[model samples]
Every structure is written in C-alpha cells, then in structure tokens.
Target chain A: MVTVTKPLSSTDSPYQSRGLLSTLRRSPLTLLTHLSVIVIVVMWTLPTAGLLISSLRDKEQLAVSGWWTSLSPSTQRLMVRSVPPDAQLEEGGRYVLRGKVSDDQALQVLAFGWSSREPAAYAVGDVAQMRKGQTLSISSNGEYELSSPEPFSGARGKRLFYTAKIPPRFGLDNYREVLTTGGIGQSFINSLTVTIPATVIPILIAAFAAYALSWMAMPGRGLLIALIVGLLVVPLQMSLIPLLRMYNQIGSTFGVDAKSYLGIWLAHTGFGLPLAIYLLRNYIANLPKEIIESARVDGANDFEIFTRIILPLSFPALASFAIFQFLWVWNDLLVATVFLGTGEQQMVLTARLREMLGSYGGNWEVLTASAFVSMAVPLLVFFSLQRYLVRGLLSGSVK
Target chain B: MTHLLSSLVIMLLGVAACGFYFVFSNWLLLRIFPVRRVSLQQQAVNIQRAALIRPWLFLAPALGFLGLYLVYPVVESVRLSLFDRGGDAFVGVANYRWLFASEEFQESLLNNLLWLLVVPACSTFLGLVIAAMTDKVRWGNIAKSLVFMPMAISFIGASIIWKFIYEYRGEGSEQIGLLNAVVEYLGGTAQPWITLHFWNNLFLMVILVWIQTGFAMVILSAALRGIPEETVEAAVLDGANGVQIFFKIMIPQIWSTIAVVWTTITITVLKVFDIVLAMTNGQWKTQVLANMMYDWMFRGGGDFGRGAAIAVIIMVAVIPVMIWNIRQANAQMEGR
Candidate 1:
C-alpha cells in the first residue's frame, strides 16, 4: 500500500491550464456562460449585421440570397459562345484573345470546364480534338480559333480558372447612402429639434420643482409630493387624444396650427416632467442635509441653494436623467407622428426608420445601415455620460 | 379723474396679483430650504414676513403647471369618460356601462390584464435571473450594461428591433427576421409570429419585457448588493445552504426593493403602447387598452368618449399599484 502511493508534485497539479484562454475554457459552466455572452452579443448584433450585408450587395443578390451566403464563395455560370465566330482571334498560328465583361469588377474567374453542365472543371489553352484533323483551342476569355482539314460546325469555348478579387470591406457606402438619399439626415435634424428642447425644458422645470419639493415647507408639501408620485403612474396613453384636442382647441383659439414643433415640444416636456422631477428630487433629497442646512444657516435663499450647492452635487443625476430624457425624446416617433407630420420638414429619424422599413422591407442594407446611423448619437451619449451614473452620485447630497 | 384713477388702480392691482404668483412660488421654495440669510440673521429679533410667505409662493407655479397639464388631463379623462363621443351630452356612468358592455373593449381589457400580469412579471423574473447569474461573473457590469442598454432605447427603437426579429415573409420567400430565419433553417415552415393571436400578444409583450428587464436587473442588482453582510453571514452560520440563504435571507430582506421594482415595471407595462404599435399596429388581437384607446380616440376617426373611458379604466387599474410603489419607495428612502 505504501509503495503504491502516488507521488505529488507541483507540476502535477490537477487543474487544467491553457494559459491565455484558461478562463475561457475552465469549467463547462464557465464555457457555457462565455458562450452565452457570445450568443447574447450575436443575438443583439446579428440583425444589424444582416441589415448591413444586405445593404452592400446588389438588390437581386439580396433578394435571392441570405446575408450568410455572402460569407461563402459566390459562383456564376455563363455561356461564352466563342464571342461570335466573326470575332474569333488568330495569333502566332493559334487564335488567342482576352477581354473581361467589365473592367476588373471585383469577381475573378475560378476553375472552368467545357461541358455545358460542368461549367467550372476546365481551363484556357485546352484543345478540343475532333475527327478529320480538326482542332479548336480556346482562351480563358472565350477567344478561340479552329484549324481543321474539315470545317467546324459549332464554335468552341473553354471554361477558365482565375480566382476573383472580392473588394475590401469599406462598408461606409451604406451609411453614406442612408445619410444622403435615405432622408435620415433630415430626420436626424428633426429628431434634434424635438429632443433638445424636450430635454432642456424638463430639466429647467424639474430642477426648480426638485428644489421646491426637496426644501420647501409649503402647505400640503407631503400631499403635493404624494400627488406627483400618484401622477407618475398615469399612463400617457390616456392623455394622447385629450392632449391633442386641447392642443387643437388652444391652437385654434391662438390661431396656431394643430401640429407644430412647439406643440410636440411642450407635449414631450409635460410627459417627461414627472420622471424628471422624481429622479431629481430623489437625488436632491439625498444631499447632505447638513449642506442645505448650512446654506440656510448662511442666509442663502432656496433658489440660491439650488443654483449654488444642490445643483453642483446633483450633476450626476441631472446628467443621467438628461441622457434618459434626451434618448427618450430623440427616439420618440408616436408623439412626433401624431403631433407632427409625415412631411419632410417634420419627420423624425425614428419615423424615417419606420418609413424605410415600411417601403423597403426587403432592402436590408438600407434598413440596418440607416438604423445604425440613427443609433450613433444615442450610443455616443450613453457611453460618454455613463461615468456619471456611478453608484454614489446621490450620496452626500443629503443624509 | 376719479373714474380713470379707479380703473387704473384696479388694473394695476390685477397685474400685481398676476405677478405675485411667480414671486410667491419662488419665496415658498426659499422658505423650505431653511438656509440662514445674513440679512435675516442681522435682523433675527424681527422675523421678516418674506419668510412666512415663501412656500406658498414657491409652490404656485409648479402647482399651476401641474394643474394646467397633469392634473387637468386626469380630471378631464374621468369627466370625459362619462360623456358621449362629441362631449356634448352628459351621461353619468354610461361610458363605463358601454366599456363593460362592449366585447371589443372587453377583449382589450383582457389583453391589458394580460399585459399587466405578464410583461412586468416575466421581465422582472428574467431580470432577477440575469442579475443573479451575472453578479457572480467577473464582467457583471458589462453584462448588466449590455442588457440595460435596451432599457436606454426608446420603446419605438426596441419595437423596431423586435419587429425585425418577428418579421414574416410569405412561402418560398427568404426570411428576413432572425426568428423566421431560424425556423427556415430548422426545416420548419416560417411563421408569421405576430399574427398568432394569444402568443402574438406575448410576442409583442416581449419587446416591453426586453426593454424593461434591464431596468429591473440594474435596480435589483443594486438592491441585492445593498443587502447587509451580517445578515447573510448569520444565515450562513445557521448552516443555510446557498439556495436556502438566497430564499430565506436575501429575498426576504430585499423584498421591499423587489416590490418597488415590480411596481415600477407594472406601471410601465400598463402604459405600454409603442411596442404594440410598432410591431403589430394592434392588429390580430394584440391590442392592449392604451393602444386601443389611442386608436379609438386619435386614429379611428376620433371617438373621445370611448378613448377617455379606456384612459380612466387604465388609471383606475394603475392607482393602487402606484400607491404601493410610492409607499415602498418612501419606506426605502426613510430606511436609508
């Protein structure tokens, strides 16, 4: 038994180690988890990818094929027919000539064969021998000549082999098209017009409300907060028609039209206010009670406390909510559509994305590339301002 | 001279009264802040009247704005619910009577009930699972952020994203939607997913769930992290295994937080319109109350009474959940 005991050594540790990819492969569960991450990323990004690949290919190819097909080598068959017998070439006792259908258009020939059915199994300079001392030699580009003791009845053509160059992946063309011809550029501008004021007006109103709600000892202050909190759950859907009618009524009264940018902006501001105030108030109320107390002790007014102390500390919340409201308003379509118009002057980017999807359903390239173009700003904003969304942004604002 | 002077004085007084609202609300905000003013401190023996009038002053503009927009709509919805399409005749409870009487409204009501039940519950459950699973991983933040990224997208964008996933093409045509492509790949005939009635409603609900799960996960993940170490340790000392500890200690402690999350998502689920609109246009029995109300009032040639009736019903359904949520939120705030 003692003799059968195995020796232990540092090099013989039971753990498997693959160095670089060790974490990736260790446990079956980890592998699955890693795979899940890959899957989720793929799941999230695949449609976008399909949209992109579809956009770049020719419309017929997109319609007939899957984007995944583009990953594999594409093949095509053509009947050369000796380039018409009158044009057959003669060179150095042999007929030879070469020209492409187009000037270096990406694809190059692969293996080619002579049989009509076996299109890619033969090559250039192959001779087709016939009876009575007859022969026909064909070049890669359907150039051929026949020298025979007996006349040839049919023109000869040879299949060829040359690897085609698929062009480099500079996929910016779809993006360019989306920007220029897709009307997304104008929609981009429209979205900005709707979003900027929609964002600013809320912050402006909410900041003031937040200050009052957080600090003011008004009558029914608790009740007011309660009512606002109660209002938070009121579905905006409930108000859509009434708001529109009200807008129509007010507009008619003021001689303003039914659907102006002003109407949409005000509508968005009203919609965004509850959440804005709630978020801002939560952050503001959490501020160090001492700070506001000290500010009050220092003889500053509530407005001054808001401007000087509370606002500075609440920057992260403001930024986070701003990103929220901005992204919300920027990506809004329904309000803009019902309140605005389909006219080029009023269409938002989201409305434009919808139109593209509606009209060009099979046009994957336009949709994906255009959608990504629309997402560009929001993604930038989220990534840039996300650092401010740290865990402690609300800490020390109040205790 | 007397008549002209009296008229000018009344006009001036009216203008002053109008101007005072802004000053008043501002003063009210000032008074609540409780900051010590040097001017006031110097005259501490004589408390200025400005301090007494502030909150009323500060609250006026906000209240006015709230009254004009937020409060007005809510009241008008309840009032409008009782009237006819034209809002000309007053008929008490007739709209409610019709809402309960109509099968279309009933169907919408049922869909909304399903939406309220399924969207939040599924989203929150999935979110909890994701947050729980991802929390143990090294790249949890990245995972959470990637998931939460959908929450950042507007309902419209998310709806469009899912539309591509649920997109349908006819027989022999190539499937553009990822889901349909998978079906074709698996040798199964492609399905028009959004036309599948009950399941299609779920399919539409999925977009809302997808967007919201991230929100639930982030908030719940934070709540999970906020849980006290000692409580967990004590439960561990009592020999609670991981599952027991999670169920007994962690979940119970985080119950309020979970409630807050659940209620927030529930409220969002109640208001969900964009996803349903973007995906199916509320066709094929996928209409929820909000979208149905929208269609009735705004799109289907404008039936204000029915729309407002639906709106009130939605509000009635949501208020209890909203109250519970605010209570929990305030409790958590006070607890902190």
Candidate 2:
C-alpha cells in the first residue's frame, strides 16, 4: 500500500494545479469536493432566499410564477370581458362594445384572441375578424373595442382572451399590509413585552443562583448541580399542562386573567432558569479563584463579592445567556400560545405568525413577510452578537 | 406606540425592582449580622450565619422559579395523569391505556421514532461532513455562518420557509416551489411533498435537518479544531488516506462531542412541536408527542389527564437523556 501510494505524493499531486504547467494533472475529485460544498451552502440558503424574494415580488406575479423567475416580467393569460350587450351603442353605423381589458394595474398587452383555444393568437393591436360580422380591436395598453353590424344583445359581457406582459414589480406592500392590517404590529409590541422581561428577569435570578452554586459552600451542591443539569434535558412539554392549570387557578383566586404578559414573563423565567444557572455557574466557577479570594480577604461578603466582582467579570457569560434567553423567548410559540393572551392586544409575534399560517396558508406574500418580520430580531441578534452566541454554544455543548 | 411606551416602562420598573431586591436584601443581611462590630467569637458566628444564610438568599429566586416551573409541574403532572379529565376523580392508568390503544397515538409514536432516527442521524452526518469540508476551503467561515443562520430562525419561521419550497401548483402550471420546480425540471411530475403519505414526515424532517445541521456543525467544528494537529500528522505518517484519517483519527478524538451533538439534537427532536403544529397541524400522519399533547390540552374544554399523560410520555422518552446529562455533569464536577 505504501509503494502504491508513492506516485501520489503531495509534490506530484494533480490537485495542486492552480499555479501553472499542470493542466492535465488537475484532479476532478478536488474540484468536485469544492463544488459539493458550494452546493450544500446553496441548498441551505435557498429556501430563505426564496421566501425573501417571493415576499418582495408583486403578489399577483408571486401567485403564478416561481420566485426563481422573479426578475423577469411574468406573462399571464387572462380572460376579460368586453362591455355587456346593454353597453353596446350604435356608432359609425355599427353596434359597438368597449371596455378596458386589464385591471387598474398597468399591463402591456402582448396578444389578444377572441377564442380561448388560441389565447395569444393575435398580436397586440391586431384586430381579428370574428366569424360573425364583427371587427375586434385591442391596444397594447389593454383598451379594446368591438363593433358588429348586428346589434349585440346579451345579458353577459363578451369574453375576450388576452396575454399580458406584467412587469416584474417589487414592493413592501406585503409587509405593510401585515403590519398595519394583519395585527402583527400589535403582536410585535406584545412580543417585546414578553421577551424583554423574560430575558432580563432570569439573568438576575440565575446569576444569584449561579454564584451560590459556583462559590458559596452549601450542603448537597453536587446533587443540586446534577439536578439542574438533568432538568436541562427535561422536555418543556412536561411543564405545560400543570403550569397552565396552576396559572388558571391562581388567576381565578386573584380575579385576574391568567394569560397576561406578567404570567408569560414568569413562566419564561422559570423555564429558562435551569440552563441559565447551568451556563452561568459553569462560567462563574471557572473564574480565577484569586479574585474572589482577594475580595473575601478585604472583608467583602458573598453578596458584595458576587455583585461587585463576579457579575461584572461574567459579562461574556451574561451576554451569552441573555442572547440565548432572548432568542428562546422571542422564538417560543408553544409557551407564548399557552401562557399569553391570544387577543389582539397580547398575542406575541410567533403566535401571530402561526395564526397567519392557519388563516392565510395559501397567501405566500403574507406568510413570508410575517415570518420574516418575526425572524428579523433573532437574525439581527444572531448576526450582531454571533461571537457570544457561538461561544455559548461551544461552552454549553462541548464542555 | 402607546403599547410600546407602556411595555418599556414596565420593563424598566421590573428591572429596577430586581435590582432593588438584590441590593436591599443584601443590605438587610449585613445589618442583621454586623460582622465588624461584634467580638471575634461573635464575628465568626455572624460570618458563619451570614455565609449560611447568604447562599440561600442568593439561591431563593432561582430555586423558587425552578421549583414552580419545572419541579412542581413535573410532580403535578404525575398527579394529574392519575386524575380524570376534570382532574377530580382518580383514574389510574386509564390515560396510558388510551394512549396505547389509540391509533393516532401509535402513529405519533412511530413518527416520533422516525424523526428520532432520521433527524439526528442526518443532521449529525451532514454536519460532520460540512464541518470537515468547510474547514478545508477558504470562505469557510462565511459558508459556515450561512449554514448556521438557520439556527437562529424560529421553527415556525422555518416551517414557512420550507412551506414555500413545498408549495404545490397543479399540473401544467409553472411550479413555484423549488422542490417541485426542480422535480419538473428533472422530468418528473411535481409532488405535493408535505402532503404525501408516509413521506411527508421525511419532508418535514428535512426542514429540521436543515435547521439543526448547522448546530451540529458549529459544535462539531469546534471539537474538530480542538483535536491536536499532531495526531493527524501521526496518522498521515502511518499512511492513512484522507477518508481513513477522518474516520480513524479525527472522528475518534471528537466521538464524545459527536455524542453530545447527537443527544442534544435528539432532545430537540423529541420536543419539536412548533414545526409540526405549523406545517401540517398533525394531520396526514404527522402528529408527534408534543403537538398531540397540546391538542389534548385545549382541544375541547381541555382534557387535563390525557394532556398530562402525554406530557409524562414525553418526559419518559427524555429520561435517558436526563440521566446521561446528570452523569455527565457529575463526572465534570468530579474532574474539576
């Protein structure tokens, strides 16, 4: 095997053909490997890219053509009717019918046909002869007039088939509609109400707990740590029914609504505690022991030491957990749906998005824009503070 | 806008209250036990008392929340599973029996099994491959970042993204969904992928795999980088090829990390409710445990016993991971 690999030495390798004089020596396998990685990246990003592009495309065009063809003008075959029989008036010794063939939107008429079988048979502005003694005329701008020697008498308008070249239009109308009219705007505020406190409240509580777990000597610290770690993997589904019941009972006793912003904040705080404490404790414990020692020597109590020393020192960990909690609470649907009010005043963004999914499942424009709106914050957090996010992931998993 | 202002004010007040509690409580503790003013013996006693009391004070809020949110609910759920739908009468094992007998529950269990088997395996495998390949090329960080971008997306948002890709148009129309478009381009009839029987589950799993592979990649990529380079050099000296070195050298070193990523994704798969709830609403054989639990919770005036029982089932499914996590934490603590 070693002798057989002698000719494949790195210096003589065919893949390193980028320099010169090795045109025939280039390895297709290496090229293929690089191409495959590119393929994977494209595959991963294509779906979101589709959503973004489709969201921006004109809703009319979005319905028919794929987003891949979003840049090109879309061609649509439409059937519109001329003026009804009653609208027909005698003009120039012929009974005439007239109306605009297209809707209010500016559309360039590419072709027109009197028959459905050949929808685009006649070029724009070409008037076709009808089998009946009538002449048809259509303009590229979608205006049409039909004249017949015989007086037209029908209750329904005459059907005219045409192909229109709709320019590729893009706008934020979808987002505007969803935000202004879809109640997502209200839900955005509600999401903030849920996320801000839910993110901040836990850090304080967990910081205190983490300090105790990390430094303060207590009985059963190991068991407590173990328990919390085990709780880390306890599925959140386990807590829902009981917590809902508890909230309902408490709300009844207090004569208040159970699904309030405060309720979700507390619920989030509770559910987020285990991971927060676990991560923060891990970091706080790893702090150089000498700092806490020095503070102790200076007559600082545990509280002072924790606040003055450990809290500031654990900024990275705090930021890490804060982002984690923020994203978790922001992206949470099940918890928000269960604990928060579903009314227009209290529905969070995720719940709002899910509602949109049910009500407007077929409307891609609405779904994509609303989904993107909900995703915007987390994506911003992910991109802006990716260092801390990645660091948290590394510490959480690889530790 | 008024809502925004009020929420902001409430947030500030809440934060202020938390700060005040910590400061005032710590101040109270110090006042109650003045270590400096006492005699040496009394000071030591004060210090000990303060030390003992301080930890509890520090741990109180977190423990309270954890107890209320996690521990209490867990106990309450167990109690609830024994009670009737109204949670009034004791009904032992009836919910479990119903769960076992219901074809919907059985289908959900099978689907959960399929999700468990496929999502973690596919995500980890693809993650490993991408992590390894991306490490070799320039612009790898950007590629990794783009791939990891999905990690930040909500599962609901991700379902919408994938939903657009799975959008179906009738035959002879221009196929808009990417999957169907590609299928049509490749000379195959477009399939409404998410609605297909027995395979729609896999189609949904693809979205999760797409989302989670980045997670696995990031963790595994870090683990791969942590592997000492000397080992790979030695493997090369031993005549190991690229594939052999990867399988024999690098993977063995990061095997535990792989397990961590796998189990992490597994836990996520077990609790994945949003994707299914949004995608198909547990229809067409796509119901998983968590969504089914949610359905039972509020389907018709709510069925507490059945809901809690379903939760218990999910909890039971997660027990192995919980045990492993505890063992791992204990081991880490011991090592420290």
TM-score of chain A of each: 0.72, 0.88
Q: What is the TM-score of chain A in candidate 1?
A: 0.72
Cα displacement (angstroms), candidate 2, residue B269, comes to: 0.5
The stretch of ten residues in a row with the least summed lDDT in candidate 2 chain B is B133-142
Q: Quote each prediction's TM-score.
A: 0.78, 0.94
TM-score of chain B of each: 0.83, 0.98
Model 2 complex DockQ against the native: 0.56
| Tens-digit lDDT track of model 2 for A1-399 | 011001111232223434432432365545566788899999999888899998888898899999999998899989987878998889889999888987757699988889888888889777799878888888988899999999987698888998898989999999998889998888888888788878888888899899999999999888889889988988888899888988899999999999887888888888998889988888888888888899999988887898799888889888989999999999999999999888988888999888888889789888888888988899999999987887778777624
lDDT of 1 by residue, B1-336 (tens): 232344345434534544454556555544554335646664553234455555455555556656766778888888888888877688888888888898877788889889888987888887776766566556556766677666556666666666767777798766757788888889999898989989998888877877777777766776676678789889889899867887888888877667767787887778777777767777898877877887878655787888898888888888888777567556555686
lDDT of 1: 0.67
Off by over 4 Å in 2: A1-30, A83-91, A98-100, A103-106, A115-118, A151-157
| lDDT tens digits, residue span A151-253, model 1 | 2244644333232323333346777877889888878777777776677656656766777887877666666677777666777766666777788898899
Question: Measured by C-alpha RMSD in angstroms, how accurate is candidate 1?
Answer: 10.9
